[model samples]
Target: MTRSEQLFEEAAQYIPGGVNNPLRSFAGMGQPLRFIRRADESRVYDVDGHVYIDFVCSGGAALLGHNPPLVKKAVLEAVQNGLNYEACAEAELKLAKLIVQLVPSVQMVRMVSSVTEAVLSAVCAARSATGRKRLIRFAGCRHGGFDTAEGDPSGVSLLCGGGQDVLEAQYNDLSSVERLLEENKGQVAAVIIEPLAAHMGVIEPEPEFLQGLRRLCGQSGTILIFDETVTGFRLALGGAQEYYGVKPDMTIFGEILGAGLPAGALGGSRAIMEQLAPVGPVYQADACNGNPVAMAAGFAQLSSVLNQPLLYEKLAREGEALRAGLRELFPECTVGGVGSISSLLFTPGPVKHDRDAKRGDQGQFARYFSHMLQNGIFMMPSQFEPVFLSGAHTERDVEMFLEASAEFLA
Candidate 1:
């Protein structure tokens, strides 16, 4: 048996399902699950000593690629100073300042431990700012294991009473959102979405979808929140808000912010952000909020991205090349995504939202994943997730990926 399997078996005795996260379990995956030991620029090394070009990219966090020199150095330096402290650290100020300077919709930012927490806080702040109680989130846009409404497919189950005030809407369909806003009226506090809808196969917004949503929210006095977790630095230095030229009242961030560490933030105009505790009425606090080590790492990563000219241009070129190759190799499948994020769906034709994305054949995708794995390319086992192109990935890596995929089709 492989060492990874052995470790998983051992873990089942103590850890639930032999994995801390459900995705890592590789449940029902055609190939064996991987337990990684180490990672470096563009690749991950499994415990079995196998190396593969990593497309997971830490769920879109390694925008500058794995173990980035600047972020690593900053982390090590901060570690030397110590950890788990309470006092506000200087690193926090620097990172927050850098984020404010980069992201267009984020004039002020409050750090949190994870994207999940940031979502909760952002929703709460929205409600407080508008004095509304209901929230409307798009279907298929998973905002971390959130307790959402009925028939929600974003990984979290709707508990008996957990989502009484939450509402779901169709993505890329502004009419559905308009209806929700009209029906809820003053009760709707916020309309939160992954502007690019990367969670479900990376669907790009239709023309004026985001702009119309912003207009509707403004007309109804509701807060519009753009979840930039996946699209943050990977889309543009200004994120989706700047990329699309449509700004939201509040923005949620994750992934690249902490330099692939456990960190996230909620940011918005001062009027909305000041509603949080110590500044206004809404109360939100965490024992480990804005940890100094995380702050230092995030600052260094952002600084590198800022200093490096044409970084996005290079990443975009690689991403488009990969997408173009995939499209040619698999005429029967659908390839979608923008910027450095891409997706492969078994279904032919366009995928604009959750329903279209769900139409893709999962069983077929499992077979493709198994083929890629056998050929030394590691992608996310699930079809719904996106494939992030890392800055560390090179021409050779892209070539290898396309070759492996072509082999699968053959």
Candidate 2:
């Protein structure tokens, strides 16, 4: 057996499912999970010494790619200074200021340790500010690990314990949102959505749909919250809000904003954000909130991103090349997404929402995944997740991916 297999066997004795995250188990692909030793640049090396081009890119957090020198230098420096102060620091202020300057709608920012905490705080603040109970979330839009809507029991009941009035609407369907608003009326506090639904295989938002959401939220006095955890810095320096020309009332960010570290933040107009404690009544706190190490890492990453004005352009060009290659090679499948994120669907064209994403042939995808892995390409095992490209991924890397994909198709 391989070293990775042996490690997995050892891990299974202690860790649940032999992995910390569900998707890591390779259950969706019906294959044994690879145990990674380390990752650098665009590649991850397994314990067995096998290397694969890592398309997952740490859930798109490593936009500059894994362990970029700038972020690494900042992290090491921060570690030498201290790990956590458990209090306000200059790093936090610097990161917050950068976020405020970059994101269009964020006026005041609150740091957190995870996207889940950020979402919870954002929703809580919205509820407090509006004096309302219900929150509206779209079906395909992921808001971290927590269950943001009723009837979605994917999250632990204990973590989702609260009897918060939550409502779910079909994604890209404005009429569904309007229907919910009509039903909930003044009781609706917020309408939260992933500006681009990466969790549902990179479903791009319909331009009219986002505009309609903004209009409806304004008309209904409900806060529109953009959960840009995956798309924030990766889509554009200003996030999906800037990319699409739609401004949300509040924005929750993670992934690239954290610079591959465990971090999240929620920001909005000061009038609504002040609802959080020490200013208003809504309460939220985390032991690792605004951790110095994470802040330093984020600042480094953000600074590098901002300094490179042509970064997004390169990503866009490469992503388009990859997408076009995939479509050209595999005419039977559908490809979707914008900028650096792309999803390969083993289904028909125009995959717009969760339901359409579900129609992809899972068995075919499982076989395709195995093939890609065999060819030294590491992709997300599930059909539901999108593949990510990073600044570190060269044009050659894209060609390699396309070549491997072509081989698999042949």
Best by lDDT: 2
Once fitted onto the true fold, the runs of candidate 2 whose alpha carbons sit more than 4 angstroms away are: 147-164
Q: After superposition, how far is residue 104 of candidate 2 from its true place, in Å?
A: 1.6
- Inter-residue clash pairs, candidate 2: none
Displacement of residue 249 (Cα, Å) in model 1 is 0.5
Indicate the worst ten consecutive residues by lDDT in candidate 1: 153-162
Instruction: Compute each candidate's TM-score over C-alphas.
Output: 0.96, 0.96
Of candidate 2, the 10-residue stretch with the lowest lDDT total is 153-162
TM-score, prediction 2? 0.96
Reference-based TM-score, model 1: 0.96
For each candidate, what is the lDDT? Answer: 0.85, 0.87
Instruction: Give the residue spans of candidate 1 off by over 4 A.
Output: 147-164
Residue 129's lDDT in candidate 2: 92
For model 2, the local distance difference test gives 0.87
- Model 2 agreement with the true structure over 159-212: per-residue lDDT tens digits: 323454767789999999999999888989899988888876778888699999
